[model samples]
Target: MSSGPTGQPSLVRTGAKAGLAFAGSAIKGGLLGLILGGGVFFFYLGQLKGPGNTAARAGGAGAILALVTSPPLLVAVLLLLFVVVYAMLGVQRGRTKAMQHLVAARGEAVSERLAGAIAGRIEAMPRTHGTLQRAADWLSVDALSKQLAPVLGEGKAVRSVVGFVLNRLPMSDMLAEWQEGRAAHGAPVAAEGAAQDPALRALLTRRINETLQEMSTPSRKPLYIALGAHAVLLGVGLWLVN
Candidate 1:
């Protein structure tokens, strides 16, 4: 069936070639996430039951360890971690893959045209929109995603394009920019020139580059997520082991 203005169905948009690429990237990242994540958790678990603690809980440790480290329990923990990490990276990989697919479908000229269109809209955002409003409408990942949907269609390419164009900065970053600039001065003076202020623009533009690099390099998001997830499992592992 046709889809959106592209007339290309979602399946066609992904294409077999792109799908395989996405899977390959996801699996590779998943394995990395698994190895790194598992290593950290294992290190912590060892520490928890390490030399000092192990001697103290020597008698109890064996029984608890048996239960916690059992084939079933170990598999479940690793499986959960793998799945979460896989999904996390999968979204990013899919976006990247979809964009490649989109480029294939539309060709470089059309792709650039689309890029120009989105950039034009963002650059044209009126100062009257207010700092927060402008940010909400044009300065956020989510907002860019929404904008990409209509022009880029509903494919994963939308997210990919958004990632390329904007960084997923925490609202606090912008809030800090706003607070330090405007609130501290005891005036919302920045509001009038927000969309056009060279300095503010430079700062946010710099932040955008920072975000883009994070998405491209992928930074440490997966590992960070892995750490947080394993922290919770650490408690459960201990509980079951005990």
Candidate 2:
């Protein structure tokens, strides 16, 4: 029922929520893997048939087309995809820890600053300790985003970091809003002398904002995925169609 000093359950932590996420991620990962693997298999099948064999030639073309558009490359693609999704979950999970830290840090930040405590808690919290680490990572992103929203508004640097995370950009239009707000208040870094130092917070916020903006634009990712998925399907379709 309670965790030991290690902060983990005496027993395994699996349950309905964990199970569902695992199943979902597994299904997703598997489907993607299958599509990728199948694409490769079909491509090879056609290649083995050689150019002399017209059917095989056409089939190979389909396979190559399929591979071209897919997300995970034929080599190391699965692990890579899993890791990307997993890291997302880690970031999300980190936020839950962030909230707990925030709550604890809130009381402390009033008297002191939370940067160290927040960072420490984040480091100490169990890193998605489960087979479904990837799923956990995915879930954590939402949690972190929600928890950090208010603090982000006040911390320009932190906000910029968030934005950069989202888009890998140094700055973005999102920062404009924060800048305007600061200008309106006439204190670009109000908490500069404070323990938390509002300016530093702003930097982090800015980076995070970048990441958020990038994520908001679903067109780039979904469209790319769609095109890649179809490329494989298209090639296969031709073979079957013929």
Candidate 3:
């Protein structure tokens, strides 16, 4: 109901923000690992050379250099790899959440449009005359299923409506099935003549198909953000390893 230019941020902007936050967290984690690893390396080096002779000091220094340049560095690289994996997962989760939010926002609009379209179609039907046509004209979205019951049957009408409204979206099947199940448990049985009307069902399906086609806009901003985030994370990880 609330339509404003600044209602919510766009999906790409949200995803970009999420990516940056994940990158920051991952860099901090990598730095912390490097610090802890370096601390342990230095602690062992100090332990290797106590108050001893110059020969012992020389040997300890050699050992420290060898350890630092080899196994400890390798461990640091491995830690960076772990961080890279963690960052990737975090970014993916963030992107998925952003996509869900975008779809939900769009879906509300689609539902409203679909409801108005269907109600208008129902009222315009030549077969639906007299009081039924008047009722359809005044039907609210909440009462649409009930109004449709006389024409399309109770269970089939709800499923048909839900499927028509949601079938093109990502979670369409899930939502339709949930609505159908909910309706089956509580909706009243349809009039005896309801099942004979295929015209209304066909009309609803056609409208949905048309709406879906209209909704399909080509946008790759999310994919670009995901790729860019991965590249940045990989670069940071490699830099940390070096």
Give all candidates' CA lDDT scores.
0.53, 0.38, 0.43
Worst 10 residues of 2 by lDDT: 105-114
Model 3: weakest 10-residue lDDT segment is 47-56
Over 1-242, each residue of candidate 2 has an lDDT whose tens digit, in order, gives 22233322211232233335445545554555456545554554443323333432355776565445432223223323433443344343433333333223232221122232222222333433331222222323334444454433233323433333433533234334445666887854232123443543454444443444443232334435544764564455445434
What residue runs in model 1 are displaced by over 4 Å at the alpha carbon?
1-20, 27-143, 146-154, 160-167, 178-188, 191-195, 218-242
Best by TM-score: 1
| Cα-based lDDT at residue 107, candidate 1 | 34
lDDT of 1 at 20: 76
lDDT by residue (1-242, candidate 3, tens digit) is 33343433443354455456546545654553345434443433333322332333456676456545554344434444543444444454444443343334444443444544453544344443243324333434445555443323344323433454444433334224433653677743234233422333444445554554443333446445544654554445445434
lDDT of 1 by residue, 1-242 (tens): 23365555544545666777667777776776666665655654553433444434455766567546454346345645654675577667655654465445543333343344433453465655344444435555565566545545655545655555543555445546745776676765343323444445445555554544444343355557666766666656666445
Looking at candidate 1, the ten consecutive residues that score lowest on lDDT are 106-115
Q: Clash number for model 3?
A: 0
TM-score of each model, paired residue for residue: 0.37, 0.30, 0.25
Give the higher-lDDT candidate: 1 or 2. 1
Output the TM-score of candidate 1.
0.37
Q: How many backbone clashes does candidate 1 have?
A: 1
